[model samples]
Target: MTRPDANPAPDADAARLAALGYTSEFRRDMSLWANFSLGFTYLSPVVGIYTLFAVSLALGGPPMFWSLAVVGAGQFLVALVFGEIVSQYPLAGGVYPWARRLWGRRWAWMTGWVYLVALLVTIASVSYGAGPFLARLLGFEAGPASTTGCALAVIAVALALNLAGTKWLAWAAIIGFSAELLGALVVGGWLLIAERHHGLGVLFDAFGAGSGSGYLGAFLAAGLIGIFQYYGFEACGDVAEEVPDPTRRIPKAMRMTIYIGGAAAMFVCLALLLAVEDYGAVIGGADTDPVTTVLTEAFGPVGMKVVLGIVLISFVSCALSLQAAASRLLYSYARDGMIAGSRLLRTFLPHRHVPPYTLAVAAAVPALVVLCSLLSTDALTKIISFATLGIYLGFQMVVLAALRARLKGWRPSGAFTLGRWGLPVTIGALVYGVLAIATMAWPRTPEAPWYDDYIVALSGAVVIGLGVLYLVTARPYERGDAPAGDAVPGGPAAAGTAPSSEPSTRRRP
Candidate 1:
């Protein structure tokens, strides 16, 4: 691989990738802001909070806003640790590539497998979430047919955006980020200042008493609302090979993505919670969709429709970013002859250098998953829950892999080193990740079907089980390039062009 700490000129990112053993294929054209835009849009504060706000509020009332803060702090640790790791590796495939370099082939393959499923399910979930709003905008009944049709339409549009190539993606991301931020800022500010329904004390009122398990259960359920919001920061790292000065720029972009996206999420959620004319009505589930009800009241019918249109744009950007990230992850594995049909899947377009086959697979699978939405409401819920669990597991794998690697004498390289803070932060991230996973997978609602109760664990087992099955049965060929850990044998650095992987003695702030 390229020297972990090396920073070549703007045009040298590709040359550095070649030194790492692959040819220069991608355009490497995304600017730093474009990278951040992609991450922000993928995180999509408006989409995540807006979609889940009612459930969260119903579960924990106004105190649900506090859960966002807790999740945000925990996720910030994960993001900080990832920033350091991505700086050292700075490869495509995000968690998959990072895991491969930190652990080994089986680990990387499994990580990518989990994350790929997560991304596809994420695509489906985002599209499905958009369905109701789109239905509202179009004056449809939001039945199974309408929602499924809306999801398919979203998938088609996102596919077109992906096929247009990375430059178009960057522009879409920038536009989407601007619109989401504007929506969050403008809508949230208006809500906060326009009408005062309650005081700030509502935020501290733990309405968890309604749950039989007390405040703890309600808080845990609400925490799930924020778990999926913080992940897209890694989307920046997924396309690291295409970003100039990736080691420096990508790491910073990841951290900033979290900071900016988290702020927007909290701002909007708090705004909505405070803006609702009747907090009691929302907590009581008075309106089937409290967010829409509150927004429609706050902005009136026609005005709320316009706001929904902005939210629709945010969803489009979110889906586009998810598809792009997923395709890059597929290409990352295929680049090293790891995935099935490697030759075809890894093929980049002749001029654009985008991986068309991977993109097709990425788009097609999600469109298919949307069909599950047509099955029944239960199926759709389970499917979206599948995405939430798979993604969190993938994240924890990377955190665990980093922790294990550090114990094995791995010292990260790059200008963005964590220095003396590395071990503590990495450990904190791991602890938080494990706890978050446990909270999400705890079978919190026993009244739901056993399948729904343990949905995360069940879906997680299936995905990981399939990955293990493939690795064991096929005995697929592993390549000399893209080995599992740092200091890959015979890589460019090993050819004496740069210093060997360093001992873990130095400290940097």
Candidate 2:
């Protein structure tokens, strides 16, 4: 397939940026394929399904596979809403800039803060999850210390590739996308053809799973499988400035990520579900590692090792894309003077056009998070639970802001739009986001400590509370160093005007 905007004009992209009241700081080296690849790799079906498949299967039985379809449809609506928003406001830092222009400074700050933290946590979680695979592949014992060390190593490698520049990042994403997709197809197809042990009826069988409320409660609890798999599409818009004709291409890339990534995830899950030989054992908690057991039986020891290597690559790419997204968000915040050390954080390399300091922070924070694993075995699990909740909350904030903007008569004015469907899509996305957040934060772990059950909600509250305290005391929005609200008329496209070559006036905090 031909790449979208195969040879886009840099001047045109820069002009679009200028019209949006900002100069292009990054190289527009990313084609639509590159953008989609970044999002796809971030979504990383192989990583998400591999990490959560066993847990989801154990929690919701074979019926849990349905959650992928349910959440995919809902997230498709979100992608539509986000597509319209990004088309109109194709700015770097995605949710932050989109929210700011749609609503106000305060709203944008909070949205960015929540989303930023979630991205960082996600980076840590992905890296940490990769630890055991890496250790296993390297013939090392997968203990707490070894796993943490491997996690740090993954973070470092991803950070170095990102620091190399936009071109390298795009290439890495494309490579990772290729390897992961091929691996999924080969493995999933082989499983269905050769290793299938259950019939289609297995999907309906609950295997005596679920609590007193029955399969309904268990299935909802397994929603994380789909919720976690669908998000990385937003990473496409996060690097808006790096993509040519972003208003048009970014939206397409976002949707493609969901369609293709969701399909891959569902295929893998279905294959794995059909291939499981002992549903009763898995569902009854006797088989804690059903995925490994199935793979070992199907592929034998050496083939399983090769699959593990592929899984490790997927994890690295996911972490790499996440780090890139997080850094762009931090750069966006700093560029707007919304955070301390704004000058340093916003400094883009003259040649590479990447924010080194922000990238360092993105890497450093996750590395520190990985270190937390030393304190307890379950720290990683608690940390990962917050990642999904925080991300959904952040997404809902943007969805809510877009709805508010629509009610105030803010029609999307860009190369792409939903036309009459805009309001309905926005409303649907918001509703889905809210319900997903509730499901993620619901306490279901009655057998564990109270804190473990409430970790998702508590972690989110802590992040939000700290953000509120800082917002109230520091009042970052009052700085007024950058454009705070929507561009006049219908944005750069509708206005048919360009901002001055000079940077927006800066105000000291």
TM-score of 2: 0.95
Clashing pairs in 2: none
| Candidate 1 residue-wise lDDT, 362-465, digit = tens | 88898888886676665555675679888888998998888888877777765677877888999999898888888877887789888778877888898999
- Show where candidate 1 strays beyond 4 Å: 1-7, 207-211, 477-480, 487-509
Task: Locate the minimum summed-lDDT window of 10 residues in model 1.
Answer: 500-509
> Which numbered prediction scores highest in lDDT against the true structure?
2
lDDT per residue for candidate 2 within 1-509, as digits (tens), equals 12344444777777767766677678888989999999999999998998888888888899899899999999999999899888878888999988888877888899999999999999999999898889888987888999999999999999999999999999999999999999999999999999999899988888888856777779988778888888999999999999988988999999999999999999999999999998889878899878888888889979989989889999999999999999999988887778999878888788898999999999999999999878976765677789988898889999898888788778788777888988888889888888899888889879989987888998999999999999999988766445545633354321123324455523245
After superposition, which runs of candidate 2 have C-alpha atoms over 4 Å from their true positions? 1-8, 211-213, 487-501, 504-509
lDDT agreement with native, every candidate? 0.80, 0.87
